[model samples]
Structure formats: C-alpha cells, structure tokens
Target: MVSCKNVFLTLTLVVIASNQCECGVYSLIRDLLQWNVAGIPIIHKTVKWDFDPEVSQKRREQFFELHGYRAGKYLERIGLGIDGKQRERAYQHAIRDQGKLQGLSILQP
Candidate 1:
C-alpha cells in the first residue's frame, strides 16, 4: 500500500508534469519530444528499481520525516517573518481593516 505522503508527492509531481501551455496544449508534448527526438535517454542500464519490503518501509518513513523538515526549511527561506504566529496577526489585521462599511456599495454614488 502506498503511504499517504507518497501519494501526495505523486499527485504534486503529476500536477507539475501535466502542465498546460497558454494555447491549451499539454506540455508533455515537449517532454515526449525531448525523450524521443532529443538525445536524452529514458533509462540507463546502471539504474534499476528493485523491490524489498523492509527497505521500502524504512525509506518511506525516512522520506516522510525528511520531507517535513525540508518543507519547513523552504517555507522559512521564503517566509516574510516566522511561521504559525503570523496567521493570528494576519487574521487580526484583516478583521481590523474590514472597516465599518457594513453594507455600503462603492458603485452607488
């Protein structure tokens, strides 16, 4: 059985891989051409996908933990300040800035 984290990663990859161009074309066209037409090899003889249940389980657990750590680091790299606490500040600001316009419409002049 595929772990939930693995499934999520697969879905994310599929979303990225199945890109749509501005003219409504599948971006896979470029990828397919690159593999078939270009000099890129689809698979190398050295690489292999072997199945071992114990290794698979251990790797999946390690991947889940590592992904969480890496994701946190990446968010920190791009975040404005810190994490979690900012949500409360942002929420309060939104509530304060909603203004007293209970039902006023800007179009009505």
Candidate 2:
C-alpha cells in the first residue's frame, strides 16, 4: 500500500544523504592533501626548469633504466602484501584522527 509520492520522497532523501557522504569524503581528501603539502620541507622544494628537449630525453631514459618493469613488479608485490581490511582500518583511523585534530566531528557510517 505504498504511494508513488512516498517512494519519490524516500528516494530523494537517499540521494541527498549520499551526496552529503560524498562531500565529506572529498573534504577529507582535501584536508589530507593540505596536510601533506604543509609537511614538505623547504629544503626539498621543487624548482621550475625551462623545457629542454635534450635534457628531457636524457631524464626519461634514466628513469626507464632505473625504474622499468622490475620497479612495477616490486610496487605491485608491496601493494598485494597489504591486507585489505587492515588498510581500510588504517585509512578510517587516519580520517578519524585528522577530524579530531581539526576539531571536526566526522562520523563515518
């Protein structure tokens, strides 16, 4: 005995709630990026260099020599070594801790 109007209202509320959740996630990512940028030391600051085709080609070749297929396999192995649940828990804890540090009550359902 459910009416179409009631179903529409329910769906609208669910969409709104999901949007709010997405906003929270985006906000958290923004905050994390800000934290990472702030933590970088001035000693390791990046320099802007003029584009030189010769230099670019040399660096590209150097990168491929140092970090080619073996590097990709090494990274994949390291990624696979991490447990999904453990990584999720660590991620959740980081969000909660960051929220607490910023005096924001971020509730994850």
Winning candidate number (lDDT): 2
Model 2 regions lying over 4 Å from their true place: 1-49, 69-74, 77-109
What digit string (tens of lDDT, one per residue) describes model 2 on residues 1-109?
Answer: 9998897566555554555565765555544544563454664688898877789888877766766754764554464456556566657657766856444566743
Candidate 2 local lDDT, residue 34: 42
Backbone clashes in model 1, listed as residue pairs: none
Pairs of residues clashing in candidate 2: none
lDDT of each: 0.58, 0.60
**Could you tally the backbone clashes for each prediction?**
0, 0
TM-score of each: 0.20, 0.22
Model 1 is weakest, by summed lDDT over 10 consecutive residues, at 21-30
Question: C-alpha displacement of 78 in model 1, angstroms?
Answer: 7.3
